[model samples]
Target chain A: MKKLINRQPGRVGQWALGLLPFVLLIIAYLIASDARLAANANDKLLPALNSFADAIQRMAFEPSKRSGDYLLWVDTLASLQRLAMGVGISALMALAVGIANGTIPYIRATLSPLVTGLSLVPPMAMLPVLFIIFGLGELAKVMLIIIGITPFLIRDLQQRALEIPREQIIKMQTLGANSWQIITRLVWPQLMPRLIGAVRLSLGPAWLFLIAAEAIAATEGLGYRIFLVRRYLAMDVILPYVVWITLLAFAIDFMLSRYSRWRYPWFHQQGH
Target chain B: MAIIEMKNLWKEYGDQVVLERLNARVEEGEFVTVVGASGCGKTTFLKLLLGTEQPSRGEMLLDGAPLPAEPDESRGIVFQRYSVLSHLTALQNVMLGGELQNSRWLGHCVGKTRKALQKEARAMLDSVGLGQAMDKYPHELSGGMQQRLALAQALIKKPRILLLDEPFGALDPGIRADMHQLVLSLWKSQKLTVFMITHDINEGFYLGTRLWVFDKPRLDPQAPGAYGARITYDLPVGNCEKNTLTRINRSVGNTSRAINDTL
Candidate 1:
């Protein structure tokens, strides 16, 4: 007999084990929803499953009467666009600043302390300031996400670059590599996979900052739509939106990890 | 001519002395193997030869001139680990030194230049017995194979001096024997001046034309770093009688054995 710590399920059993919690949660939700509907029939807090289906159909399939656009797709597109812009700019900045800070002593001395200080700042606290300056436009929302995650990404990449073995650097130097060659040929390629990993970790916080910004002031976005329906206690609409956002986040993370594995097989080998 | 000459070289870091009063003259095509107890500055000596560390208090002349402050293509180094880049295939790793030298900005060459470099790199890999594994990444290759790739990478530059800091220390006994043969052949054919550091006295004697032993003659109990290691014995290989081996082994004592046991 195996000890509890040593025991692990086989493939079939593992699949069943993984699904058990989700199945239990679904059953619990169904039962809770049935009881709430039986008692009040007008409970918005725990809407019946059919109400959620109806909300999804309305938000995703039907065009709005006033706007004549499918609300869900429009909201998703707007949110994704802002998220892409903020994160893209952050990635480029982190790569340059992080590699410079990691590889060059002068740049590291000049910028490392500043980056550390910026990371220590609470990005949420800057939201009001950002809004006042950038005027509640898309820039403010994007800036919040950038301000929230770029410092962290830069620090992560800097540490990753520093973690490159000292021997490798010496070996390259002995091979007649100049400073620029070492950075472009060695450090840059090495940090790309790490950058992807860092971005994956930052995605959760990036989403949080993005949603917060949108919730405060936006015409249409997942967060804005969710907050707008809160006065009506529209749990069906809110729940569906929340689930959709989560699915999107999961899909993005999955794809990024897959891409990293595909592109940098060597990095994944070290992980294993 | 003496390709490298160290006149009373010393290396110290802050209050701590690492090596002191070291003097040696290594000629071209000479294989010098260094053996010492841990913290005896064998690696520091190798770094000095590789041009990564400048002598703190003495002069190191290369080819009748002062050694460069930084490492360059005239010398190449291979460590026990991280000698090969993980991102590059075995072929690309060999070509990297050449590619960087040819192209100033991009560190890559294209078309005819690329083809010529590729052919040269393939030949270098073949010389190191990694011809079939040219496409493999460093992680995919075995430890011995990876070291072979590392050797190929260093040799591609046609460096006059090769500094190996226990390049085969991590390998198994069988693999180490194979590497020894490969290295001896490379040294003879390339006419390279080799400086290798090893813990095994037998390896030092077997592989080197000249064997250097570093030890500290003075020590203070209160301050461990008070005295630094010096080249206590510089013996020519093939002429060191049995008694000399016993004397060195006895003096090196449990420290060398401890290092070997851990390995």
Candidate 2:
């Protein structure tokens, strides 16, 4: 029998291939924007690059007349604060609940079904309930993000914890680890990389929930600003805001991936 | 006095019995190897000895006391895979025994105690010829090297009884030979009461001071679950220097013939 080799592109070539689609997307958008502007000169659907630049300059660099704050910075800070709190709390809760459910038969029986049911309910459907209970405040918005992502995160982490080899637990037992010790030492450390991965996955839904929450009601936020400007068809501001959100999300994902690679080198190696 | 004893030990799951009416005694510091065919419950026997599983019936005693309901530091086990935590480096894995024993929670050992344990773990790794690989993770090590690391992790606890479940089953022949030497030397130096299960008959004979072969005495095609495996042959191999292979073959042959006769 002959050995089969993987004939893939080199690193630089792979990078170029990955970037090609995005480059083409930007070129397509630019051409459409140019054609629309040349036709109508006041097109709101696809504004000129200069209009987008002016919108960014005003929103980010210039202070707002009402609050004396840069709206773009203020919105970014508010959205990020909510996102961090929501994702952070959800991750910690998922870790604790997941470990308990996976390790203890009684806990798994009690909560596994509830968690599955909750994950099945579309989080957006709960937006009205959150608004009614929390009264359209930051609390409501943050809770929306948490409620949206926590169940799925919990299930993902629970399954991961359950997948831990029984031998490892038994080995820890033989090494004198008690139930709690087994969870903390053997289970928790093993679950961390997976936890980071789960958080990264939940980020997309997290942003969606946050924006949905803020779109309906909020005085200050990226979502709130975008929805507020939609009445005037401010595509310039809306487009830049979307790009900024994407950049922020990508930055978070990149950092998390790097952290896992750095902290759990063995886990990363196993994937390869 | 026997260090490990099982009287009329029987283990069953639902209607299927795995080990039946096993009565055996293992003296202290004896290297005992158990061999059997596939699905003959060799692993279940080890689990019972490790106190990871309770016998469905009968008693297991360790050092004149009833076996604990849960596994403790008195017993250390090395599995064929996942014997060591991949997240921890070799030194950290070796230190885990003392850390788990001493630390109240989260397996944290701090201050001078932690430093001393670190030193001890380093020495243990050095003993296993893994001093330089102390900073490497289990995935970075080869199969043989990982097994050595696992050995270090188990021996660090200074367990009274060390249990091995085909620890070298995944290694190549050359590595398996090296592991045999390493295990023997560790056993002798530590004076450990060792219980190992393997599918290799020669390995069972070569390493064990005593050998146990497990099989079903009676095979009923209609009701196979009606009977379970028992210790068919228990022979002393420590002093049978020249005719060890002959003895193993004869004993195994007689046991099978006896089983067939009964059937």
Candidate 3:
């Protein structure tokens, strides 16, 4: 008989194993909710599954009385817009800074220390400062997300560009590539997949900053609604919102990785 | 006139000398194979020719003019690994040299020019026996195939000087033999002035028209960096006797063992 560590799961067995924990968690939640509701029908801490469905239906299907808009879709749209602007701007900035710092000695000498210093400063500590300057609006929320993730992405990409083998750079030189040619031709293409990878890694922190900013200032956002309903301990609404955010993050990460694998097949061929 | 001339060339880093008092003249279309102990300056010598490293003192002349401080279209090089760009396909890798030279700003060519380049690159790849693998990436190719792709890439530029730094050092013996034939045919067809560094003596003799041995003539027990390697032997190949071959083999073997023992 094979030992437990030596044994490998078949495809079907692996799928069953992956779902086991989720299945068990749902069962436990049902039991706990039933017990809580049986003891007190007015319980709100662990709302029943039916109540969760009702809350989602109200937020997603029905229009809000005040704004006449579907609240769930509206909030999702607002949150996604902020996220896109912040991440898109950071990706562009990171590409410029990473390539310049990685390939050019003069730029690296001028900015490497500055980038290192900025990366070390706690981004959350800048929340109040951002609110004060950008004001309590979408710009502040988006700025917070950018501030939180850009430094990390820049450093990651800069290190990636530096990791390009010296032999390749010399080979390019021998082939008559000027400095600009090396950057545009060799470094740029090589760094694309890496940039996507860094962006994927930074998504979690970007979401954290986005939600924190929205909770503090925004009038309409997933995070804003969760905090808005929290005064009444609206776990029914809060739980669903949290789950939706998780699904969105997972979808974005999955798509980015798939896009990288599809668009840069050569980059993925070496298992990197 | 000699295509390349070196007079009392020296290379040093801080207090350590790497190569010293080297003099050589290579004519058009000569294949120079360099062999030495591991720590010797054979690679340093190649770098000087490739224009990656400038001599700390002394001069190197190409076509009776100073060698370019930076590598240019006149030179092409292949290394033991990573000679081919991983991101580009076999055809794209071969076209890159011409593209960079022609398209100054874009680093890639446009419609008509690109089509013409593609045709030429395809022919170059076919010449290197990689016609079926033109669309393949470096990672998709085997070690020998990647080296072939690299050779195609370097030769497409029609460079005057082709520098190869142990380009087949990592291949299996069977694959290496195939590469040797491919390289010799390319050399003759292109009329290229070649410089190759190799650890294997038999390979050096078989592939090179002329052979150079780099060795340190003076070594002090207290100061190893005080002296540097020099071109201790310069011999013509093809007419060598077995007696001379054995002598060179024994000396190279002893030098390698001595260097390895110290490490």
Candidate 4:
């Protein structure tokens, strides 16, 4: 008979185990904050839990004195808008370029190496160039995100599209699908879930680029807020903002995962 | 009149000849099964017929017209593996042919048309003995079931010519026999001009109205490229008595096994 209480822990225990590190991290931060405060009453590197709560309450609930807008909400909205624009544009562009690269031999032969070379170049190094050309406006910031991640995403999607079996393509042709029909009907539908998966994998680098761009030059954004508070050593504000960014990223990743699983159950079943 | 006519078909990749001086004719409603050693250009022949590959030197005619430059709706094929899309349900896979035929780019059927297509697809799945598994994905189905889905997908298009490239090579013995019966019944009912390739000698003899044996006629140690596979034996099994068929089967089986060993 199967034991109800075996040596192994159940689902709840497993979740607790998974979250144990985070709990330990918060506890360690609290302890460090207390020790630092005891040693130096003015220590700003690590702030107390109440200080974070107060900072969050102010940024989240209260309007800024100068702008009269909830700063955290405003920053989140702006950052998400930019991230969405950048990632959305990149996903579309990657689908087009990746499909071409995977399907058209001539296009693949010409563009694959170029894409590889472009991916190798550090996107941060082009920041000055982008700013010079597009100015220090939203375009430059969004373009920075695009340039940072599009090539990698394109390569990822191209590899995935290419991995589609030759037999399927031939079979599609035999099924009376023209070149256009084959691409739009057969390849596109199949690649969409994989594209979503690629975008999910790319969210980390995307956030990195978004934050770097916002940190360098931005009037309002979570990254800009964090960096701006850094001058005053406002760990209280910066840490919460960082936590907020982490939460947003997690939420986006979770939503995308659920969407793909729900919308493309067959893709999920393929063990991808 | 022949449904498919190939005259002196020679296929070569630079100096390496894969097939040479192959001439054959397949009439409508004939079940032509090709048996050959590995690397004997059985697949290349099918590819040529499907118009996926061009022969080096030959004329291939379908219904007395020159074959099309590319695969079209007139010919349908089921490969040994990766025959069904992993991202589509069995019904969706079957409906894909009609959907593509009806719609243009991004051809997603909707409303009454979609309902009609779904109905047709469900009927196709039922015909393939997969009515209960219409919603199941390819990975969720067994090997035989997946191949059945592939058959439904191929047959849904209702092509005049059906190509099967070792379609049952991967199934278990019992399932393979069932599939053979299913495919034969479908062919007879549909009057499909079937071209199949198989490694199994018994299957090749049992299923086909006509049999083709492809093998290199000569061996050259110094210049292997000088020789390529040809139709060494062409036998009509349509009117053969049972004893004669058994004798022919034994001889052909031995001949193919010998060729396979040599190759």
Candidate 5:
């Protein structure tokens, strides 16, 4: 919560600041729309504002739900499932492959140049090639995302693993811990914070790719629905679809970052 | 066996030599304290004995064999810092060394092995006067308590040789003296061969059966910084009051004064 102001005048000033932008926009709109609406006040704004408020309220209530009719839509179970499975599996694979690259010096040396070379190859250019290999499928979508995401995961986690305290390494060595024990007990546990951040960042790109993936060849999902609307120029459907995607993205980030905080409470002990 | 011996040891970094042509020995079940002023290679010298660092020009023998790649069950080290795994309880930290000696396969075969390790760890903690602190993390404990935990962690394996690197440097004065007494008692009770580093002259003078000083031997004749990093004091440990003890103190004082005035 915000620190509430003490004095009534001071409180009013702060609240006025909060309302300023919306107030200014409304005032401008009312002045313009008033002339258009002189015959009837409800003709200018009430229906649109009421519908907008309803959409927002619907979103606020069942945040975990993706639902229908309102502009704030992730508004369906199927769309949420596709996102959860797609992003969840891809991010997890990225973490595993990336951690391996970062931890094993030899593997990193072997894989990095190839990855760097491949990264330069445009992802869209591979779409035709992937269609032949994967046969118009989910495999192509998930794989495309995995490729897009693994490098970031590998780089961030590698950096995090590298930054583990030197003293701890020495202590583990003195404790007679073998290399595997050190990585499993020390390195992986420390990777939780950076891993969560990596997952958060990758979620945005994953969603972007999901829409692209679904836009290509899907049937039932949000992207497919948006594509159907695009054929008819139904801005209502397309705009609401985008609004819901953004809402879902915000929810995804909030939940994972919350989990990151819970799992690694000592993360704030760092300089940040 | 002398347990540890350094023969004509030469440790160097590039063109600068740290410990040059130095011969040292440590007997089984004895306490030796090495002390020196700043930059005296006191730490590097101990690292060689601890098997953390290798002597560039010579070899060290432990228990009649060449030094192992890792310091073995026969030797344990207490570093200058707590070096206790912060995530582990004090008891867990103490139990860590002994646990390392147990094979994971064996533990898997036998159920409830942690309870056994916990019991042994508790015994070691009791000896270090930290039995009550067994459940706390190193960060939750004071520096003195942490060192005591480190001491237990080091000695729990019942290693024949114990190496401590300025273990009391971070403790308050009162804690330092109390820890010093604890170290003395533990050494006497266990009949443990101990090697320690100390900056406090009184500490070195009191704890060591014999004291060695480290000074950089490469200090330039005309320049200030080129002096040897450490100088050894191969004298016996004693207090100030007795006749023999007083004589030894005067000799140590004179030698220290002479080194101060000269190099």
Candidate 6:
């Protein structure tokens, strides 16, 4: 049974993420009770979020004196922007499409050349063509990001899926699995790490690519902010976002890698 | 109901022939092992059975029907290394093929109705003496444990025919015996037909009810499969003595005896 808490090491983070909302709700109720006592009254339902927002603000603004904190905040805020767009929406789309390609041989074979061809081209080179079609908006940026990363996922995930032995698939077949079921049960579970890795690797580059993506936009975003600051020769602000990006990308890639290792420890055993 | 028949089976890779006009029948729920030297075509034969390769020349019939061109969920394979999904824990990997073959919403909705799948997975793990390591990933366990998990995963789908490609080739001596014992037990319990390929003569003799050996004359430039290309032998299963290996050594160890005499 899927217990409230998984009893396995290397899986706590994943289960916790799966169970995050309930944890947050419990914490919220506890805090609500404390505030009710402090105010000496029954708190109204639909309680305000000022406390949470205030906590975030404090964390963001608190350790400005420390350069490291400043750097962390800058990167976090930058990723927050891209995550809202790229990782949030386009990633899901790419996963849906990329995983499809990985699961089915026909799709992979048909789209491989085009996908690989697109992946090899610099993201900058494809910007103008994307702009021409989507017309200078979020659609173009997201599309470019998706196009840029989808191929990497297609290629990576296909090989990873293939790495799943032909016998495993055969075994499943003898047990009586249909194609769709096989994909969900056998293919997706195996490709989870590679897909997650592809998404993580795609993230920072998506942000960097978004810089060129947002060239048409009027304002907002660290990428745009960088271009604006660069104009005024405000290297300090620009430098922070760049450094933030590097660190954020590093951290995300690291977590993604560790998660992959944790999720599928079997792959390492054959060699070791 | 679960009989495997090969009719004039010809498997060739390019011009090389692994099996030339070979015919064999694997009876229902029979435990058959294919044994050969390093260069023999036993691996190729197993691959053909698993539908990993085309007959290049013939077809395989499963239970009176032609074997599907592609692998089916009903057909579970546990290879020496490929059986276990590298990322999932032992229980999860064991449950994976079953869930895929049985459930529709895996990794999305409930991902196999945790209770039912877990129950089955736990049962499978327990049968393999891996109840303690159900939650542990493959790498965290010893080689024997991983092989057990692999076997459990192959058995996950309750397959009528289990195809194993030297699944115990990587295990140490003791574990290899344990694995062989586990297979014999599972085979009897589940009434499954097993087809395994191994280079280990002891393993071939011990676990398998029938031994199919594919031998070829050392590379004849003119003959096909000089590069280990030929379907040379397929023998029926045999009985074992308390120390059958020692007895076989006394009989077949004459070559060594001859060398000793010369020395």
- The candidate 4 chain B region of ten consecutive residues with least summed lDDT is B251-260
- Please give the ranking of all candidate structures by lDDT, highest first, separated by commas: 3, 1, 2, 4, 5, 6
Cα error of candidate 5 at position B261, Å:
18
Ranking by DockQ: 3, 1, 2, 4, 6, 5
lDDT of 6 at B30: 83
- Per-candidate TM equals 0.97, 0.92, 0.98, 0.91, 0.76, 0.71
Better of 1 and 4 by TM-score: 1
> Tens-digit lDDT track for model 5 on A106-188?
88789767766765776666766777898777677666666666666766776777666655665555656666666665567
Per-residue error for A171 in candidate 1, Å, reads 1.4
**Fnat: each model in turn:** 0.81, 0.89, 0.85, 0.84, 0.19, 0.71
After superposing the true interface residues, what Cα RMSD does each candidate give? 0.8, 1.0, 0.9, 1.4, 3.8, 3.3
Candidate 4 scores an fnat of 0.84
What local lDDT does model 1 show for residue B117?
97
Superposed model 5: Cα runs more than 4 Å off: A1-47, A51-132, A220-243, A265-272, B71-73, B103-110, B221-231, B239-263
Q: Give lDDT tens digits, candidate 6, residues A192-254.
A: 766776777677667667666665552345566566656756443555456556776687778
- Per-residue CA lDDT of model 1 for B138-220, tens digit only, reads 99999999999999999889899999999999999999999999999999999999999998989998996999988776755
Candidate 4 structure quality by residue, lDDT tens digits, A77-178 = 999999999999999999999988988789999999999999999999999999999998999989988998899889988998898899999888888788
Q: What is the lDDT of residue A89 in candidate 4?
A: 95
**CA lDDT of every candidate:** 0.91, 0.89, 0.91, 0.88, 0.69, 0.67
Put down candidate 5 lDDT per residue, B1-263, tens digits, no spaces. 68788777777777666667677777887788887664557888777776667878888888767887654456677777746766567876777765655643221112466678878889889988887887876777888888888888877777788888888898788988899899999998889999898877678878868777665444553443333343444666773345644554554455445446665
Give the candidate number with the greatest DockQ: 3
Pick by TM-score: 2 or 5, better one: 2
RMSD for all candidates, in order, please.
2.1, 3.5, 1.3, 3.5, 6.4, 13.4
Docking class of 2: medium
Off by over 4 Å in 2: A1-7, A10-12, B221-224, B238-263
Model 4 over residues B116-205: C-alpha lDDT tens digits?
999999988999899999888899999999999999999989899999999999999999999999999999889999999997766877
- Among residues 3 or more apart in sequence or in different chains, the pairs in candidate 3 whose N, CA or C atoms overlap within 3 Å are none
Instruction: Give the poorly placed runs of model 3, Cα more than 4 Å off.
Output: B221-223
Error of 2 at A61 (Å): 1.5
